[model samples]
Target chain A: MSVASQDTTIRTGRVTRALIYLTLLLFALFYLMPLFVMVVNSLKPLHEITSGNMMALPEVWTIEPWRKAWSEAQIGVQATGLKPYFWNSIKMVVPAVFLSTMLGALNGYVLTKWRFRGDTILFGLMLFACFIPFQIVLIPMARVLGIFGLAGTTWGLVLVHLVYGIGFTTLYFRNYYAAFPTELVRAAQIDGAGFFQIFWRILLPSSGPIIVVSVIWQFTNIWNDFLFGASFADFSSQPMTVALNNLVQSSHGVKEYNVHFAAAILAALPTLLVYIVAGRYFVRGLMAGSVKG
Target chain B: MGFLDIDNTTKSYGPVEVLHEIDITVEEGEFLVLVGPSGCGKSTLLNMIAGLEEITSGEIRIKDQVMNGVHPSKRNIAMVFQSYALYPNMTVGQNITFGLEMHGVPKAERDKAMNDVAQLLQIEQLLDRKPGQLSGGQRQRVAMGRALVRNPDVFLFDEPLSNLDAKLRVDMRTEIKKLHHNLGTTIVYVTHDQIEAMTLSTRIAVMNGGYVQQLGTPKEIYDTPSNLFVATFMGSPSMNLIPVKLRVDGEAVVAETESSEGDTLSLSVPNPSARLKSYNGQTVTMGVRPEALTDAEGADHRSTHIEKVLNKVTVTEPAGSDTFVTTTIGGAECVARMRADTEATPEEVTEFAFNMEKAVFFDPKSEDRIV
Candidate 1:
């Protein structure tokens, strides 16, 4: 090639790369706009948030709204903090995530390795559970929980989240384990390892990436869920998301936009923290089935 | 009774039976190889022996103990899989000792066994590496180490070397042979590669279409295959099969075939079996190994009958030491192994010698040897 043509090619390459970066920057800004608004409004005084620009930075950055949102925000008839509700969410989510993830791992192992005659059909039905909308299950779930005397309890919410979240977690683990070599399981059996032994020793240790994906997914789902939390949680056992909704929609003498924004950010912190801590594994888990190691 | 006996064993999936009534008796410390093409039920038989698959009707006995309805772990067998099947998460040392750990062996004893096996397989340097970190050959060694540390009654190999590259496969093949010699454990190995079966087996059971076509020592199977399938499948540049009409001459039986140029060529059969008398005036298949057909100077001098024929060579493939010269006999392709220096060129007429002493005749209708 001539030098001039080579120069042109290099110039075009630079232009294309700059164009790609510019497009990505635009998307980044588009997605981050709501979080930016929430942070900016949460720091501003109530009058500044209500009367001034939503995009403008707070001239007087004070953490008073955050404190009030945490301890003094009025949620429904109660004027107490979102603190108790946050604890409720944690109490419900920890066990729900733990139990659901364990169940999903076992389900994935059995479905892939020790599959029975109708296992494919059973897995298909479990997969179909992931697509069902939450609205369809609310009334029936409420009646079932009521029958079990758990209608308004935190354990009821935990059970609800566990049941609903299992489908997605199982799907994640099942797809990941399907690509795993069955020879390992066979070798384990020949080595005198039984079912649980093979799973615990040979399979579970290699399940790091998928477990992270499932945990993050279930934590996010159970933490941010408001429908079940609102419908099932009593006032004393209301989750953070339900309390956040109540705080935002509750009418008072004047609107507390700063408190509402601060509450929303506070409610979102745990899931965001989970993603930030182990985001690489989440990507690896997503690409597990498509790319074999 | 042999150490491991599979008597009238059959395998079926619902309505379709894949393995017919298989009767194999493997003596203690014998290296028996089951070889066949894909879908020939060799691997299924190996699984049945390992107690991984349920026996359909017959009994599998190991050391005079019945093996039906037993779990694979209880059967005391270790299998090296084609994929190596190393635990991806465990270090090589841990993988080797996992079987011992499962059987509740003491840690000191397990370590001693692991060290011994690692040394035996020359994988001591790879003890700390995970399976993913090791190379293909290293992972295969670790797999063997895992199986060896168990010290099971029988070692089952399911095409274990099939995953390695050509050069590594030969090296591992030799290593496995040496290991078998040193350990002398009874082994039931399955493979589709006939060369592997011939090189490693003390006895070979060649299968086709769910039947054991022939079972014998490597030399016997190579010299006199029971049927046409075993004859064609057991050798490289496989045995050249020519359709020839049999005729009883004054004192000998002769096979009459045609050259590539449609010229008649007659070869006298040496020491004709009584069965050939009945086959006279009918067409039969003459099975001749490529080594049995050579250039005139390369013909075996000890053979009682040698016939020289000139045929047009269709192709000449020189593989280092031997040149495979292809020509047409009875309108079918035949290969002759000649010395590399032979002047056999494609599309040129070349003089070749056929050593009739080692040739076998088969009934074309039954596809079985007419012995």
Candidate 2:
């Protein structure tokens, strides 16, 4: 209405837009800088990598490191290297993700739809178990695995991953299921669907985002785990994470930057591929729990 | 045997008692509505009948067989939820046929049933689409289709129209009534809305505080409420209740209020019982529905024959069909529904005829109807 007021409004709007742009620019840098450095350095030779400025561009780019890492990283037991261990990681993670997702869906369905005495206490215990650190369960879980003669096998790690993964997966599912109306569950019951029938046919079909979330979370956690892999399995059954630790992280090495960098990239590729595939569902699932529909 | 008999049924969750001594016997092909405000145990009662909730203390018999411990799927009942609980992943056809498939119906029969219900609900074109693809009203019809395909002996609807918009709700309400008319299946519906109760129910059970306050046909419940709660709950704009002292003026009973006309309005009740006559000098509550009061001269109804009471109208709300005039009578505010043609200015004293013929008297202490 007035010249001064109109001028102030325009100035304020411009400032707000500028502030938003500045904030986004900073956040993008914060997330992408490390990734950019890793990709660029992975292409550099040892001399170029060790010449001190790690963030600087390479003098020459070559795929030699990737080639060497794959072959020299041994696809067999004698070498304790990347290729064999990577396949082992895949084998271990696939089952863990599948089983964890299925069990999480079941847990969510029961907690939200079924009513019984002490259901609250059971839910509270699950929440409490989620807050319990994995460090506290190591000895007891190892002992249990030893009794089953699965202490050093891939199946043993699968069990461990599933045990730890259920806490988070169930929490994700339980909260998601809470948002669904109880009437839907009742209708399913009246439709003559049994427990497993409802889970597989009715509930699971609509649980797109939650299934993706549980799979991605369990796969990433199992693939990235070094401590559990080292403690639970020996060299033969060891996953890439543990084997990579011996290859790149052992203090006795002469610090083969090329091999270390290449191995790190190789190990991270699975999770990166998973994120690219399930990125949308992961974000949708997270938003569903925290926001109104 | 009755079509569905719930005899002395009760439900309690842990320490919380939700329903008490519920008894409802729905005749074959009858439409029953359970109407009450939230937490009044109407939905719980419906759920118990549907076998969704466990009955704590009595028997539920369906066509002479005990159904108290039976699972919901085995109860021979179909329920339409308030959320229109159509499966999001299944097509409308798949959703409708799911119940029949679970019951081991042959493929041919299931298809025929699905097609029949879809055609009946006029959703044949939308049968291939998922619930998410359809609009709210379409999803509701699909839900109904699912229930109808089951061909259960009884249908239970739990506030099915509460989710729809006002216009959509009206349309669905009529569709449901028409569906009942065609199917001739017994139905037990639950809703907090009184208008739905009045329109959809063949028999309305008004529940309050975990008890059935009154149960009757919609007209009976509306015209002759058993108690103060039913009288107030059944009607829109509610019934106007005014406290007055009953006294004998010569040969007739006179209820006098100083604030209203500053005098007594003498009237007589036919065959007054000893209990009612005992309160001759005591205070009682008189309830008059808004529709009962009109422009004294316009309707020429029996309401005109009673004593003419003069009062000042404070507000006149003209709602298309009728003008709701709020006036002060007997020191209390009373709403009278007049013909839309009636003209009255605010703050002007007007003569409103009283309708004693349909009016009810309540014992002020207990808030129960007095015979």
Candidate 3:
């Protein structure tokens, strides 16, 4: 009788697990539906998209919409391409991410290890910077850019991102460093290592997960940003997101839904690639960085 | 001038003083252990010596040179932390050699030093392994190797064996003592373990409430503790303190204590000091070790003074070689050590002999030893 009862329990456990998996699969599909629709419609020809079902695979797949979205689309007054703006984004993001991450590392090291009186208050004020909405800073930043004659330039956009991104990068690194053992730093000091030497040899080498976290966080934030990009950039320096917005909204002719979808996908490729390459570290970094010393 | 001297050191944060006027001096090769319970400022003192924490007031001198504001590296000291503090990203070899590399030592010299330390620590096989890959004992060795490669003027160890298991702790304790003997380097170790302090130190500074309560050899601290706190803190199954009245009985100084049943027990004190003579008719504290009170037949009869007392046994705890027999005296629980084979059952009155030659007296109000 006990054997039969155990068998019944095992069978019920299996059925419960199966039901959980079924529910998860359905939720996964629901979340993926828009992405599926975007890819399907982006691949379809204009005539097929106009008449065929949205859920169906493209009856006649074509690369024309992707081509047009890249080179021939109208973005604002310019009809050049997203290719130039894509280069603009690369120029803006590379330096911005690199500079902010370096500054944040220094900030974190000093804030956590070499702290002085009022340092905690200073860090708290800096943390307040991370929560401020971009709209709140937009006007003053634009005015500052104008005063410096940096308005509507790639450098101006880089400056804007750097100023705002430092807060988040600092927060990430500070949390990560707070959990790092402090004895290593003291040991290095006694080993005759000076400040920068300790940072370079001892601290930086152990900062792999946090570096990934800060870089990816800054890269995605600057890449997908539309408000700052549009406000700070001009005709020649607009980022890919702003250009994509203009490309879809410009109504020189009938709406090209397929081209719009392709353009949106093209604009999102870099961030998606970043996630796919280093996605595992992202979660690990977040979890490890949150642990307090 | 002493090799290392901490003179009139006091540490305070805001208005709260943590360590108050601590003074310690060590010879060239003395092993000094600063021992106390947690929050007793032992680690704070060590850190101040290492220059990790600033000294608020007082002068710290090494080799007769003042070291008040000297950087830790410039002061030429190495520390073995409780956590080991090996660089997790570096291999054992690199960890050992990092100090040399920081001082701009040549690659050949660094490697030579690293090899010597690794061999000394018997960690040559672990040179290529990262700290994360090594066991607790191996990591401890690597931490020591890191400090050893420096060959600094003084060595600081902060509870270095506290993280190990019980068995490993004992093994490593012996290893550390052997290492100290082989090197004969001046060492200042901090620990809360009384046994570690007693076994390792050439001189022990017993700290309490941030003050150096007593500074002496382990034997001196154990046999002639200066006060009530030091007497109780240094021993296991600590020294039993019973309230007693001192009286002169026919030229012999005797301590009189009352049992729970209102019977008086008188034990004669051997060689009572001149200072103890003033408290003839007043109350005082009598501290006796459990070994001093034992089964009558097995008691050491060679002592000059011994008193037999009959008390009802309240409990018996057999601890392998000796059994601790507990009985009530003057409303306080007193333990007597007995031979394990002795049949002193609980609830039966047993005759135990008390050796009074080693007993000490403390003033009731001040708690300071009378002599």
Model 1, A1-293: lDDT tens digits are 69878777645577889999999999999999999999999999998987889999998998999999999987777678798899999999999999999999999999999989999999999998899999999999999999999989999998999899889888988888999998889889888998899989988999998999899989988998889988999987899988988787776667889988999999999999999998888988778844663
Per-residue lDDT of candidate 2, residues B1-371 (tens digit): 68899899888988878898988899998999999889999888888888888889989999998998798999889999988888888999999998888888999999998888888999999989999899999989999999998889899998999999999999999999998998899999999999999999899999999999999999999988889999899899999888877876545566666444566555555345566667889989888888766667644454434546777889999999889999877777889888887877688878777766767789977888887
lDDT of 3 by residue, B159-187 (tens): 99999999999999999999999999999
Q: Candidate 3, which CAPRI tier?
A: high
lDDT of all the models against the reference?
0.92, 0.84, 0.90
Per-candidate total of colliding backbone pairs:
0, 0, 0
Please state the error at residue B150 of candidate 1 in Å: 0.8
The TM-scores of chain A alone, one per candidate, are 0.91, 0.87, 0.93
Please compute DockQ, using alpha carbons, for every candidate against the native two-chain complex.
0.85, 0.72, 0.83
* Candidate 2: clashing pairs of residues: none
Best by lDDT: 1
Ranking by lDDT: 1, 3, 2
> How does model 2 do on interface RMSD, in angstroms?
0.8
Error of 1 at A289 (Å): 3.4
Pairs clashing in candidate 1?
A: none
Interface DockQ of candidate 1: 0.85
**CAPRI-style quality class for the chain A–B interface of candidate 1:** high
